[model samples]
Target: MNDFKQELIRYPAARITEVAKALSGDLRVRILETLGDMPMGVSQLAEALGVAQPTMTINIQILEQAGLVVSSPGANREKICYVTCKSILLELPVKTGDGLHRIEQIHMPIGMYSRSIVRPTCGMAGHDGVLIGSIDDPRAFYMPERTDASLLWFSGAGCLEYLFANPIPPGVPLDELRLTAELCSEAPSFDMNRQSDISLYMNDMPVGTWRSPGDFGDRKGKLTPDRWFSGTEYGALTEWKVTKDGGYVNGIRATGTTLGDLSLDYSEPIRVRLEVGKEAEFQGGLNLLGSGFGDHPQDIVMSFVRSIDRQ
Candidate 1:
């Protein structure tokens, strides 16, 4: 096994062709499976798989290039190969050309929150994985460097609000509004069992609440920098959506709030707020991970779907 022991990896669309091509060969597939069982030298792998050294070397090169396997120099200059991920996840967009709807998406960085109300155990970090300003200091959220934050966390109760420019074309009827983020409970160091109730608001209207299972730190996040060692490695990807009917979180009904309740207008900005209310049963706080620090290489994403037929 590798030193990092990375368990899950999510690839971006840019690498789909390379990864798919690398796995196209049966020999390369077998090599990865074998390495998953145990790291081995090239010669040993060749012998076990009934392949010659030259063939093994070529196959290993492909896997290495695809980032499916990692090889390090061993004694006698022999190369030791190890599988990099136990599980791989990729999100593919599905496009249906029926022309019934148009979808617009925008990525909002975690640090770009326009307003915040936080307390102790609150801080932000940039892509460098270094903490900005001081830890547990609310003032840190106001630092100019905040716009560069790739990750942020807080304990107790507070709210972070962001304003997203409306992307729907004027006079178009909205169908569904969706927001997604990588999130989890916050704890000092780390605790997998801690729970937190996180709430979402759109245009100052309560949307719903999500009770996160825990703060995950069992393994290092796929995108978390090697330099980051202050705990809280990754988070669960959560999506909240609002439609004409009601609000939903991952397909489950979360609130009676509806799209009409938000009174969205294409000319106005959308105010999205995430908070941990003081009255919440679980005041576990929250950790919001960005593209540079989570298993998913994305920040807060919002999607606006417009009804093509409705004027």
Candidate 2:
């Protein structure tokens, strides 16, 4: 049998040793696992694992030095940390065939806020005018309808769908998929009582859901305009995730999904739909601001790519 170890040896010994050393310690492994889903502060990780803050800090530092972890400023001056690497590939006994290896990532790097002045009682619609509408008349300004809808509010349950001409190819092995967007609200306050649930879908299939704490329109001029300032306050910062098995929000797992999920084909016609509402009761609404809300809106971004890991 041909020795495949020789092929593996081609990788620098220092790099391999770094990867092994980072994985050798149980504490380091735990820290990496915790960061797999989302970024967390040292205090939160320590509290969750029932460990000392120093222990968590030490392990995280090691991981960071090894290039396995990344850190940034968190809410309220806390240092937030997240895993930078998702997977590792090991050389096997068999020689792999030569083929194309592609990795694609799409990001909608914009904040949410509205601009157009809609008349009171007048419904805000997208540039298309036939896509969808918001629940409340005043709230319509924030709906994800037009590329220009910078302001959006959702009370009870509401759904918005975006149409795209390019769809994903039918049979491509999918590696990892995620949908990230920034969200914040001013409402019942940033407490548990003031909460909102968000979900994503494709072809009517549920992708994932995230429950966010309301920001209780505490800070002035976050969502509502100075002129339209109503007494009702609510807010939240949220991220919704979807994978082959299922989905999650913040860091909690949500139900509904199966394995071998279809890979979205960007070359074909595609549509992405978002749903936001209260689980038991109408808690509050959401604000979506982008070029898509105006008379001449931009495209609602959707991305699809293939990888060898899935195969």
Q: Please, what are the lDDT tens digits per residue for candidate 1 over residues 1-311?
A: 36634788887654666788999999999898787758899999999999989999999999999888888899899999988888887645333322222677899999999999988888888888999999999999999999899999998788999999986655567778999999999999889999999999999888889999998899999999999998899999999999999999888988889988998887899999999999999999999999999799999999988776642
The C-alpha RMSD in Å for every predicted model, in order, reads: 11.5, 15.0
The true-structure Cα RMSD of candidate 2 reads: 15.0
Give per-candidate clash totals: 0, 42
lDDT of 2 by residue, 1-311 (tens): 21111222232322555567878999888887776657789999999888999988888888777667778887898888876655655333232221222433343412222233323222333322232364346554555643443434345455556544432244545544545444432242233355566566665567666555553444443334444333322233444445566765565667455334544455653345666643634334444433333121222344444455534
Best by lDDT, which number? 1
What is the Å distance of residue 159 in model 2 from its true position? Answer: 1.2
- In angstroms, what RMSD does candidate 1 have relative to the true structure? 11.5
Work out the TM-score per prediction: 0.68, 0.44
Model 1 CA lDDT for position 225: 95
Give the poorly placed runs of model 1, Cα more than 4 Å off.
1-101
lDDT of each: 0.88, 0.50
Residue 280 in candidate 2, Cα distance off native in Å: 4.5
Cα lDDT, model 2, residue 108: 41
